[model samples]
Target: MKNRTKIALLLLSSFGLMACDVATNTSPKTDPNTTAQTAVVSEASSSDNVTKEKVETTKAEVVMKAKTTSDGKLILGEQEWVYIPGLKESFKARVDTGATTSSVSAVDIQPFERDGEDWVKFKIEHDGINSDEIELPVERWVKIRQSSAEGTQRRAVVVAWLQMGDYKAQTEFTLADRTHLTFPILLGRSFVNGVAVVDVSQKYIQDKHKE
Candidate 1:
């Protein structure tokens, strides 16, 4: 009887070991494809984050560059507020790259001789407002062909100090009647050359002149 009991105990032990082995073998195993897919998703997410950071950095740089120039010149827009020292007031000015010479609104323009030098007297008039009579030495005279008229009209040019933003310089301006024009002053390439760059799409890019 003792021998038979020992044999039955051994048989039970063997069966238990086999069952454990079967359970271990049948247990759910990790799918290699699923692990690979997870790794790929993680890498893609990391790559997307890096791309977003780069894009944001590029956009910020573009914005900063738009407000400034690489050559340390003012960035002018289609229109700007220019301060004329002679008039002691700021006026709206049109920035025209197509024009070769600047012009200012003037009326009662008369040319005379002063101390044996050519001089001109005029009053700035625009938009129903008129300035005091100002006399300046004539720098030169130019005849501009009118788009509406068949003949050319003569105008006197004078050197005037003008301030736009932080830039101040003396430039030549042709005296002409501009009461019907939108802006009293027209800035041309002569004024903008080496002083600023024109961005026709923008307006008032520079701060208004003060004092």
Candidate 2:
């Protein structure tokens, strides 16, 4: 009778142990494909997070373009631009820091040889305030350095009449088809030298920023 009782207790204990093990092992048995799918999903989630972060960082860096300045002068960069309130049109330009002269855009720079003197005839949009074309006469074609995206460059040039900020300055500019450039007029050292000092790190020094 004691042996029967001992056998019954042993059987019950063995069954309890089996039940505990089964309960502990209840994690759904997964195939290799399921495990791989889980890993892929996790990896894709991580990649998506990283991609979003990169896009946000790039957008933050692309704030409005800052204008160029140096000391008290406004230094124009190679392809900086400014709005002429008088002309009502934006002039894309390549700024030449090395040139002693500045230039404006003109079309049909034709050479008219007379009395062994060389003169270029061109059409100035002239403030572009009026659709009426103004014929501007050139004095001479002088060699000047033109600043470009590449570097400071030398080129043949001519002069034109331009008004900047209540100041009527005789600006010397090469006749350029600057329809493709950023600013239509190249503000060389001659145009900016004694007039205003350039402060390279600032743009639109006259404007206020909203926080």
Indicate which candidate wins on TM-score. Answer: 1
Query: Per-residue lDDT of 38-151 in model 1, one digit per residue for the tens?
Result: 999999999999999999999988865564588788898899988987788889999998999999999999999999999999999887668999999999889999899999
Tens digits of per-residue lDDT for model 2 on 58-155? 87665333223333344343454444433444444445667656666666556665667666665544444222243344555554344645554433
| Root-mean-square deviation of every model | 6.7, 11.5
Estimate every model's Cα lDDT from 0 to 1.
Answer: 0.90, 0.57
lDDT of 2: 0.57
**Lowest summed-lDDT stretch of 10 residues in model 1?**
63-72
Instruction: Tell me the RMSD of model 2 versus the true structure.
Output: 11.5
